[model samples]
Target: MLEREELKLYNRQIILPELGLAGQEKLKVARVLMIGAGGLGCPVLQYLVAAGVGHVGIVDADVIDISNLHRQILYSIADVGKPKAETAKQKLEWLNPFVELTAYEERLNTENAARLINLYDLIIDGSDNFTTRYLVNDTCVALNKPLVFGSIFKFEGQVSVFNYQDGPNYRDVFPEPPPENEVPNCDETGVIGVLPGIIGTYMANEAIKIICDIGETLSGKLFSMNALDNSMNVYKITKQRQAISAPVAANLAASPDREISMETLSNWLGETPDEICIIDVRETYEFDDYNIGGLNIPLYELQESVDIIPVDKKLVFICQTGQRSKIALQWTESHLKNEKYSLKNGIKHNL
Candidate 1:
């Protein structure tokens, strides 16, 4: 279950009809293992944590370098010489306190690959090398875990979801790793800074979709995007299809049952005022000027006195823009699990 603060933090996304509370709940329960804390891993980690993935493990043994500050946006010059995994965890904590981040300041190797991958529901290959990529992929396949794969070159990048619901996998797409001599090093060949950012965001998006189990994911398809030419392509990856379990129903619409309008609130007050708890998440100044007679609890201070917000009645959070109210509902006691809602659009015009 998502914490009260998480509801407020992810209010913008939680209101999404496609994602709704159910999809956000799915994201909150997902445990993801990310291999590498380099170019692609940087953005992947940032967004995954921000999106409230329950637990994330970062695997990287490398330390920051002054040169890495460009594409690896998570690090700064002050972070140079610090281990990437630990540094990322430290930085990401400021991004989302609700996410549980673990740093393995060690490389993912054959010895620990299976053990580490076993702990996560999903795997993402953001490593810069083929050896690490192949290892992560094979381990994911063996463990029957879906993998979100991404790679960046100078101006081009590729993204794909492998072994998703028994669909195509990395080995099925690459067949064999390129010869070591033939592999181009980002250090030697040099990569454009913006290239990884574009690719990394795509990888993060794919991870979210995978976690929420929504949309036509890149499963059985490889997406290639080029920055220089401004081009994109989707290539079919051939694999013997396996029977896929029908995914849980997604894109649940925001039901009126979960949201309240001014008219509805007024009716509820007239009929059963004893059965509802209205919380005005606006400031004291705003509540003093006008309110529908609810406890005045500013959104910022909601976490402190959240326990006082009664849970037995139908809870309705209200604010001027409706955004804060959505966040207010999220800040309510998670353990209560009662009927909770946010005023739709706010009581500003209705008043």
Candidate 2:
């Protein structure tokens, strides 16, 4: 049902034998939801809109920072401090006025994950952290939706399609999230500027193929690429239906009961500094560079040094973001009888 103007606009793609008018129509009617508007999201959003995805929804609560300009190509210096989803929507609409775009300027949490995901036919994850990635994958599995997943670290990138046609998913590959300290994100370990572009384009290609029914999708395999060495590998992954373990259940629960906001922590520290004990669970280097006055106890050493933490004071655990702190909170809750809390969203949000 393409109008005259729409046909002319997509003439180049319409000419392809594998994707003629019918395929173009399929693209026109497809609904896509992108989880992040960061490094990987920039290219995926650009190509999807240019390819004529009829309806695109962007979900990201982050604002643009000067440091993001290198990999996140959609924004300019002027866009710093602006909400990513809204800025991306403005730019995408200009790229293809034929497509409709919706911007959700909020983070995707457990409470709203299901509802937001249900609104779209496909979910493309461009998230950087394990927490959101796991949440997205689990939600996709629960809703029986296809998820195009991509991640970048240093010069390496990985892409895959999960929960498509009963295929293996993120959990099927990793089973459980890695120890937060074991895996460093792009913020801690820098990525090559073009790595996300390469992987994100592949993700966009998978989405296009899925929508047009053109070729085989990466449903049961993981695609890994190294930009530095130009090495590529595809690994076969199998789904494991084992019952969720206690740790995995704790992660899934994502309870708010143990979380303390930055504002609340600041106020408490100001009024009764002696009553609070902040244990920074980040790596030593991270703590040495910048810290908000806390005892540095790297997550890997927490078990050996658990006894050092004071049980009398209101214990608050913090890490770079919040994933490690959550894990630390779980460990402390199981072993110690102290009043424990995790800084909500970690120190990153506060800074």
Q: Give all TM-scores, in the order shown.
A: 0.68, 0.70
Candidate 1 lDDT over residue span 1-351, tens digit each? 877888999999999998889999999899999999999999999989999899999999999999998899999989999999999999999999888999999988645776788889999999988867866765665457899999988888999999988788786787446767899988898889988888888988998998897888999899999898999999999883232221122111123566778888889989999998888877677789888797998655665666797768888888775655654454343434668877887786576
For each predicted model, how many residue pairs clash, with residues at least 3 apart or on different chains? 3, 0
lDDT of 2 at 126: 96
**Cα-based lDDT for every prediction:** 0.81, 0.85
In model 1, how large is the Cα lDDT of residue 17? 90
Residue 249 lDDT in model 1?
21
Write the residue-wise lDDT of candidate 2 on 1-351 in tens digits: 999999999999999999999999999999999999999999999999999999999999999999999989999999999999999999999999999999999999765776788789999999988889977876676556799999998999999999887777787787546766798977788989988889999999999999999989999899998999899999998765421112322232236878889999999999999999999987777888789987898765676787888878988999877766766676566667878888888887888
Give candidate 1 misplaced runs (Cα > 4 Å): 240-351
